[model samples]
Target: MLKVDGLTKKFGELVAVNSLNFEVKEGQIYGIAGPNGAGKSTVYNLITGNYRYEGRIEFDGQDITGLPPYRIAKKGIARTFQVPEIFPSLNVQETIRVGSRFGARGGLDKKHSDEVLNFVGLEEERLQHAGLLNLLGKKKLMVGAALATKPKILMLDEPMAGSNAGEIADLMDLIKKINQQLGITVIIIEHFMKVLTELTETLLIIESGRMICCDRPEIVTSDPRVIESYLGDSYAEDK
Candidate 1:
């Protein structure tokens, strides 16, 4: 489990993230959504210790406010960026191996690495250069690298970006498997309403860097404020 209270991040005169409070229960798929500049990614940066912030962040009951990014990753938290970051020269297998090597345990976990490769559907492409992958393949590789870290909680930022409908369906199934089959707690920050509603149990909506509402996906999506600020009138009728 993770808890955040009064989490605020300021850059110069701008407050990217306001006083925010939320919790992600163990073994649950959590969702975060808001329009651009709502500080959604800032929250992720704070959680991962990318920048110094005001307030408290607790993971599994310990205060992790100022820990470095590596320290946070060591504490069972791993995340993917909005854009897939891959080493151009490294092969797919080698890239994931690097992840396992830098993971909490700090070793080459061949079994888990192979499992991640297969889980991400890149088994056949394991020997291919990571830079050559298509968009979807690159995203899968990104997720695989995070999985190789053996994280208790996986935070995905815009995992559905730049995908077709079929690709979205494929990824939804993959995300479900990551939560259900792997039993890993998930915190996904996404723009796609359908992905958030269908994949997550608890949805937290934010606006102007603060919490707007946090509840079941259906309820949060149907809320009038969410419809007004983000979802629009059409989403309410879809319910």
Candidate 2:
């Protein structure tokens, strides 16, 4: 559904993302992993048109390399940041309504907004202020807002970053529902290897903005170079 070739993003003398190439198939859950500052988020920035990149990005067969972020979002691509982004003052339902109005293709749908709130498991908190929610609640709200956009492909950046084991499991289940039940393609960037192996069909490993390996999760984790550069010898030994 999405293709990237020779993707390079440079900031002054530092090359954040260098010649990265990968593809995300429709209705598939793809995962990306690397150490911190490996340009993982930068790739998302480029694909979402937040940066001027020196490469080609095609979604559904059309080039979207230089398009504005809003334009890209309008084209069935939605993303959630590493940190939870929510309106502190707005109630859960109101915040979701805002997304429905602005993010939805055909504009606001009140019925859909209510359904999304319920989908994210925030139905009881619909009238509660967003700021009053806990970490997991806030994260759910963020994902719900993204879903309100009605995207064909959803990109999640560290969705389980600050969650406990139980919360992680909950988020994982939600992700599966989003992909399996809702039929939306997913691209996730996470540090947790087990999460990637269990949820993603294909995993792409990168370091210093270059592709290390792109293959099945089990295969990529076993790659010698991948272990040396990112997964480390401990991960290899664990297996």
Candidate 3:
């Protein structure tokens, strides 16, 4: 479980994240969404220790606010960027092996690395160059590499960003498997309303770095303020 209380991040005069507060229950698929400048990604950065902010971030009841990124990762938190980040020259197997070396909760387990490769459905491409993969393959590889870190919570940023409908569906299934089968708590920042509504039990909507709504997907998608702010009036009218 993770709790963020009064989390505020300011870039000089611009307040990117303002007093944001939320809690992620264990084994829950939590959803976060906002417009482009809503500081959605900043919240992730704050949680993962990429930025220093004025708030408290507690993971598993321990305060980890000022910890560095590597320390946070070793504390059982792993994340994937919006774009697939991989070692171009490294083969798929080697990429995962690197994560295994610096894994959370354990250290350099070859068996676990192999399992993660299979878990992310990249066993066939284990020896292939990471940079040579297609869009879907690259995405899977990034997720696989993160999995090799053996995290208790997986924070994904815009995992569906460049995917088609079918690819979105595939990612959805994979996320479900990661949560249901692996029992990992998930916190995903995404733009697709369908993905959030279908996959998340609780959705957190923000606007200009402040909380607009935090509730069930059905309640969030129907709220008038949410429609006015992000979903648009037409979406509400159609509903």
Candidate 4:
């Protein structure tokens, strides 16, 4: 479980994240959505100790605030960026091995790494150069590497971006497996309403660094303010 209370991040005169509060329960998929510049990613940065902020972040039970990123990662929190980051020269297996050896708690878990390779559906590409993978392949690799860290909670930022409908479905299935089969808690930040509604039990919508609503997906989607600020009239009419 993770708790973020009064999380605020300010850059010069601009406030990127303002008094954001949310809780992610263990073994559940939580969702976050907002328009551009809404400070969604900044919340993640604060939770992962990327920025000094005015707030308290507790993981499981201990206060993890102000811990460096590496310590936070070692304490069973892992994340993926909006863009897939991979080593161009490392082979797919080697890329995952890097995380296993460096980021994971026990360090260099070969059995777990092999399981992750299969879990992400990258068994055949094990020896292939990481840079040669296509978009979907690269995304899978990124997720696989993160999983290699043996995290209790996984945070994905815009995992659905740049994917076709079929690709999105594929990823949705993978995310489900990550949560259900792997038993890892998930916090996803995505623009795809369908993905959030179908996959997340609770959705938190924010704008301008403030929460508009946090509720069941169906409930949050129907909120008039959510429609006005982010979902828009088209989404309202479509429902």
Error of 3 at 194 (Å): 0.4
Tens digit per residue, CA lDDT, model 2, 146-181: 899888999999999989999999999999999998
- lDDT digits (tens) for residues 40-107 of candidate 1: 98899999999999999999989999999988988989999999998989999999988888774767
Residue range 71-152, candidate 4, lDDT tens digits: 9999999889898999999999999989787675988998889899999999999999999999999999999999999999
- 130 in model 3: Cα distance from truth in Å? 0.4
User: What's model 1's TM-score?
Assistant: 0.97
User: What stretches of model 2 exceed 4 Å from their correct place?
Assistant: none
lDDT for each of the candidates? 0.92, 0.93, 0.93, 0.94
- Candidate 2 backbone overlaps, count: 0
TM-score of each: 0.97, 0.98, 0.98, 0.99
Error of 4 at 191 (Å): 0.3
Write model 3 residue lDDT over 130-174, tens digit each, in one string: 999999999998998888899999999999998999999999999
> Residue 123's C-alpha lDDT in candidate 3?
93
List residue ranges in candidate 1 displaced over 4 A. 237-239
